[model samples]
Each structure stands twice: as structure tokens, then as C-alpha cells.
Target: MEAFEVIQPGPLTTIQDLGRYGYQQYGVPPSGALDDYAFRTSNLLVGNEEGAASLEITLFGCQLRVLQDTTVAVTGADLAAALNGSPIPGWETVPVRRGDVLSFPRLKSGCRAYLSVVGGINVPMVMGSRATYTKAGIGGLEGRALRKGDILRAAAARPVTGRARVPTAHLPAYDDQVELRVILGPQDDCFTEDGIHTFLQSDYTISIQADRMGYRLEGPRIPHRAKADIISDGIPLGAVQVPGDGRPIVLLADRQTTGGYTKIATVISVDIPDLAQTKPGDRVRFRQVSGDEAVTALREYERKIQTVKNSSA
Candidate 1:
């Protein structure tokens, strides 16, 4: 049955999940929620499977009406959400009866928030995912942002038989100044020592020009050693490339499959969620780590997710 109708289109709302994997050969970039940890946690809280399609709302003002009874949970940014005029707590699943109204006031902290339902959004899957890649016009409801008066359908989910809650300890804290972990990259040697030091030592502010493709940081311009352009090679997510301008750009989910720009480092997957929540003018610093250390941190984060799932069970 249908879930809700968009009464007001937020700043940027799109359907997303873990993302489409193993499709880069077809020139498809894996498009998914920017804050994956929060997205997955929100889905789990509502008893939805991992990688379920959830609405990713960016810095506020979204309104929707529930057309059917549903269980939903919000995670990531504290958007000051309310259901039927009553404030709803973030990181907890709440039941929404038919005809209930859901509204988001504004972003209290963090840039994006995820709203996950029990069964997930019922949208046609493209390349095995319901993620909305607006640039390519694929996935989601007509592959676009939710507009006013747009009705959204949701898969039929079993009634809530048990309470599944995300433990308070597992919830990430929102901070205006975020420290992101990175691993020195494929083109680390191409940058001067001073440039590399600047990236680690100086604080950069997130620019207002951020989007799904990449997040631009406004800081000391980092210059490259060689002036010649390099051949475009496969670029990974979190690649922090310093183009001709010297400003670092951290490529996100919908980034191009390959690029020729010199990359200083890559943000570890575990910390990308923190990067996603950073807004314009938010201060951020990067710390370099060894590959082994990065892997260990990722494993630890996965263990925490598993612990939460077991506790809920």
C-alpha cells in the first residue's frame, strides 16, 4: 500500500540505500545515502532489512502525510522532526497512524537526515537498487527529488511485533567541527610536502557548493608538483583530489568513475558518515592513518553495528 504524499519538497530529498555495487563497468557510479551508517541504523530501528530505500533529507523543510499506518525511524541530523504536531525523537522508531502528518522544521545539527520505514519505499529498482541518481535520471520515484503532491508507495511490511531500538551509545554525536580520518592516497607523492602538511594541520571549512558529487573545502590552496595532466584513472569514493586551483575536493557517492586530478588522500569509509553531516562553514580537519589502522577501525565499527543488532534481537 501507499505510505505518504509529499506536501512540501524539502531542500533535497532522495531515495537511497547502501548503493548499487559491481556496476561501474557499465559506467554507473554507486549512488546511495551520503551518511550510510545513519541510513542503515535508521532502517534497522524500523525493522527494515539492511540497504532498504530511505528518504535522505538535506537541511530541512519537508512535509508529508501518511496514507497508511507505518513504523518509521529517523537518524543522523537532528532535524526537529514532528509527527501529527508531536515531536518525535531521533534514533527511535515511532508508529505513524494513517492520516498523520510528518514535518521537519530545520537542521539543528548535521546536514542530512534519514527517514527509514519498516518495509522500504516501493519504487522501481534500476540496476538492482532504488537509489535516486538525479544526474543520470535513474532509480527512485521517477528518478528525481520528491515534489509537492507526489505520492510515494511503500512495500507491505509486517506489523511491528517487537520493539527494535538503536541503543543510545551507538548513536553518533553531532558536532560542528568534525575530524575525519584519511589514508594517504594514490597521488600523495605528487603534492609538495608543505601542501600535504597543510591538509593535515590546517582546518578547512565546508563550502556551500557541496552536493552528491563532491564536497568542496575552502582552505589554503594546495598545489601540485607537476603541471602536466595525468590520464584519468578509476577514482574511489572519498578521494580527496586537489585540482589546478589547489583546493581539496572530497568526492562522494555520485562522483565520476574516474578523474585525472591529483588526489592527496582518501577518507576512510568508517568516517565518511561524519563528513556527510558537515555543513557549509563547518570546520573539519583530516588525520592520516595507515591502511592497517583504517581496516581495524572499519572492523570495529562493523562490530558495533552487529552488537546493536544482536541486542535488538
Candidate 2:
């Protein structure tokens, strides 16, 4: 089978599509790309379907040797990637030949990166998705991160000549501090007005406890009007759940199926990628927006993605 040989699987690298859906009722977490913009862009650049399987590299990156001629595109974080020892620009489609080695020396910005080939990663679909949910040891390449010598097959049988490039205006800029828009939530009334003020006004530093499951923020305590306990409720993506200790945790793709803590707000869908790119020690600020505003923002985001897809096509 035509595939790329894993030479050095960096800190964390896994195959992921959009996500595993419709199985959440069975307690399955939606395991997908942290940065939706980058994931979709990478696929578009390589002429693959927007939800095609791609590699999500975290903090660091890996090295891979092409076993066949193929077209590839790297998106999300700038990992200072190189092809055959020469620096190769990301966010643009590039061709690789058999035996060509790709490496990422260091991270320049952002927390994760996505690598996509013309044909998506040809991993077997589990629950209708090739996404990897590492916690349960399901999906992806062997239901885990890739290891040295592992082979990743591509869906495309032959190399493609697609030459897509993401516009600079569409690219995201990463920083140590990010502002995430939120919608005051189902449990907002549980928090005191002062607590809501503190949450909206204060800067919460991303704690080391941050992971794919959630981002624990360390900052001023958010006082509750009563108690911080809630009947275990369905945890939504980007749910800002606050525990008894008063710290807020913004849930992400791998968040638990249910959470008992009171959720004060939900990070807007459009800003989830910005939060996902944040690393430990980074600062986060929340801004409250009306539900209508959030819906408009999401629609705008969808239009932006559609524009890129149209251009690529």
C-alpha cells in the first residue's frame, strides 16, 4: 500500500477527521482537530474534502518519509517545517517525491499543526470517523499516536498537482494573550453579579492543568450565589464549567460527556480555535455577546470557510 513511513513521531501526533458525531449519547467524546480553521484549510489546500483525515501535531512536530509521490499541505501552527532538509513554507500546497523526508525543527507560534495530503489519511473509519480519541483508546492509527516506523496510507492512489494557497488575510495570528467571545449560559444565574463581572473583567491564565479535555484557568475566583454544584449535565464543546474552587474550565473536543460543575458561559464556536491554540501560561479574557451576535459570528465564519473552499475548487 502507498503510505508515508513515520520517521520521528514528535510529542503528540494523531490522525483526526472533523470528529466522531452521533455517538456522544453513548458517552463518546468528539475527538477532532483543535483548530478547525487550520484543519479545513489544510484539506482544501490539498484538494481533499474539508473533513478528510489529517495529522494533528501538538506543540512539537514529527518527521515523515514519503513512500510515494504526493502533494501535501501544512496548516495551523508554524512549526518551522523542512522538506529534505530545506525549509518549506506552510499554508501552501507542496509536492513531495518518494523518499522525501519532512521534519519540523521547532515551534514558532501556536500550539498545534495539521498536515494533510491530497487524499486524506487512509485509516479505517471507526464510528464513521477516522478521528482519534486517545482517552478511550479508540479510532486513529491503532487508536493512539503514531510511532516510529508506522506507516500511514493515503486515500489517493497517485500524486496530485493541486497548488492551493491560503490568503494572508485568512491566516490567524497567535499571541500569548487571547480574547474569547462567550454567551452567558444555562447556569449563569448561579453566579453572583460580581462573579460575572470578575470573569468578564479579569484575565485568566491558562493553567498547566490544561489538556485536550479542558483549559483550566487560574485567576480571580468567581463567587457563586449559592453553590457550584449542578446535576450532572451534558457538557457542550467550549462549555465554561466552574468548579467548587471557583476556577473556570473551558471544555474542548475531548471534554467529558457530562460535567457536574455549574457552567457560567460557553465560548462562542468561532473563537474555539483561538482558545484551542492557547498554551499553558497564556492569558485568556472572556467577552460576553448576545446569542444573536454569536449566531452571526458563526455564520460569518462559515462564509469565510466556504470562500476558501470555492477558491480551492
Candidate 3:
């Protein structure tokens, strides 16, 4: 059904779900929401599945006009969202009417926000996913960021719904600095002991060159034992690769399928959402954890998500 009409397509608004999976071997990078936690929560609030496509708004919010009555939820960053000139809250569901204007006026926190409707933003799914990979011009409304005058259609959803909320304590916290947990391995031996210590102890700032692909950090160069190059190998999400210059690049959802740089550590999956919310100039520190600890954290994270999913919406 007809859903939203774009009045203003902010800076980098795009459609994303969980991501395009199992196609990495084909060199297709998984392009999805940077903040998957927010993305999933937004969907749950609107009675949609976790992977349902939604609008991922970057930095500032966009202006979208509702074309039908629908329950909508906005999650992640607080953008000072307003519905028809009245303030509306985030992390909860709100009923929007036909011709109602949903607009974002200011960015108060985080790097991105997700807007999910009763069904979901219905773009033809490519590669088993509705994610937009702009670099290759593949999924999502023409495979690019949302454009003005774009008419977004929504998938059909079932009846029987009310309001849902993610408790304030459950919401993600944002600050100037965030500590990301990592499991050093796979290529950690390539770096000297001092390099590992620097990576785990020192503070690094997100460089101006941050994007969906990766984040280049600027800080003390991590001392490599000899070289930083490696045989071309598959690069996983959140892989922290140290290049010849010693700067580390934290690969993200849109990272290349294969790379030659030596990866020093990998940010844990549960913590990647925190990393995704970081903006340029944010300070980051890494903490090393054991494989078992990382697995336990992931299990706990999934449990929390399931708990929220079971709530009455």
C-alpha cells in the first residue's frame, strides 16, 4: 500500500533492514542499517519483523508525508521528531493519519535514526534483502539514498496492534566516548605486543572519513611487527585492520568482501551497534575479551531482543 512521500530526503536517508546475507563471497558487501538495535526495535514497535525494511536517516532527519493511516515508530537517535507540528516521542509507536507530516528538525544524539511503519517500506527485494547498496546500484528505491518526491510503498501488515515501547533504561546511551569490546585473533600475531597494547589501551578518534564502509581512526600508530599486508582474505563485519601506516580501519556493514590489510582485532557483534552510533570526533577505546565472553555477550543481547519482541505491542 502507499506509505510515505518524501518531502525532504535529509542528508543520507536510505532503506535498510538487517542486511543482505550469504552473498559476501560474490563480493557483495552487506549494506544495512548501521544501528541494527535501533532498526530492530523500530520494527518491533510497529508489529513488524526484525528484518523488515525501514528508513535509516543519517545525522539529520527528513520530512515525510504519510499517505495512509498507519502506526509508526521512530528509534535510535533523537531527532526532535514532530507529527503535524506537534512533538512525538521516540522508541514508541504513534498512530499517524493520512496527510500527516512527519519531520525531523534537530539532531540531539547518535548518528542515525530508523523510522518504521505498520508494515514496512516496500521496495523490491534484491538478493533476498531490501537493503540498499548504493555503491553498486542494487536494492532499495533505485539503489541510492532517498530522494525528494520519492513515493515509498509499504508491505501489507496484519491487524491487531496498539502501542509499544522500549523502556528508557533499555535505550542505548550515547556519549562523547564509547568503549567497544573486541576479540583479538585471526591476525593479532601480525602486530607486535606494543601494537596490541596500544589497540586495547589508547584512545582513538573517529576520523572525518567515517562512513557505512568503515571508520578510519586517528591516534598513535599501532606498531606492527614487520608488515601490515596479508594475503587477500575475507573481511568480516567489525574487523579492525591495521594498514601499513598503522592507522586502523574498523570495517562495517558495507566493507569489502576481501582485503589484504592485516586485521588486529574484531569488535564483538553486540558492540557493533554502539560503534555504529558513533559520529566523527567521537572517542573510542577497545577492550579485549575471550571468545567465550563474546559468545555469552551475544547470547545475552539476543535474549534481551527476544524479551522485547514478546512484549504486547
* Model 1: residues with Cα > 4 Å off, grouped in runs: none
Q: Please give, for residues 1-313, the per-residue lDDT of candidate 1 as tens digits.
A: 8899999879889999889888987778999999988898888787778689999999899999999887888888998999987899988778889999999987888889999887899899899999999998988889898899998888998866566777877889989899999999788888889989988998999999899999999999887787524688888999998898889999999999888888889999999999999989898899999999999999999987776666552
Residue pairs of candidate 2 with colliding backbone atoms: none
* Top-down lDDT ranking: 3, 2, 1
> Which candidate comes out best when scored by lDDT?
3
In model 3, how large is the Cα lDDT of residue 281?
96
Q: How well does candidate 2 score on lDDT at residue 29?
A: 92
Query: When superposed on Cα atoms, how far off is each prediction in RMSD?
Result: 1.2, 1.1, 1.1
lDDT of each: 0.88, 0.90, 0.90
| Higher-ranked by lDDT: 2 or 3 | 3
Per-residue lDDT tens digits of candidate 3, residues 162-232?
Answer: 67888766778877799999999779999999999989989999999999999999998998899888899
For model 3, the stretches where C-alpha displacement exceeds 4 angstroms are none
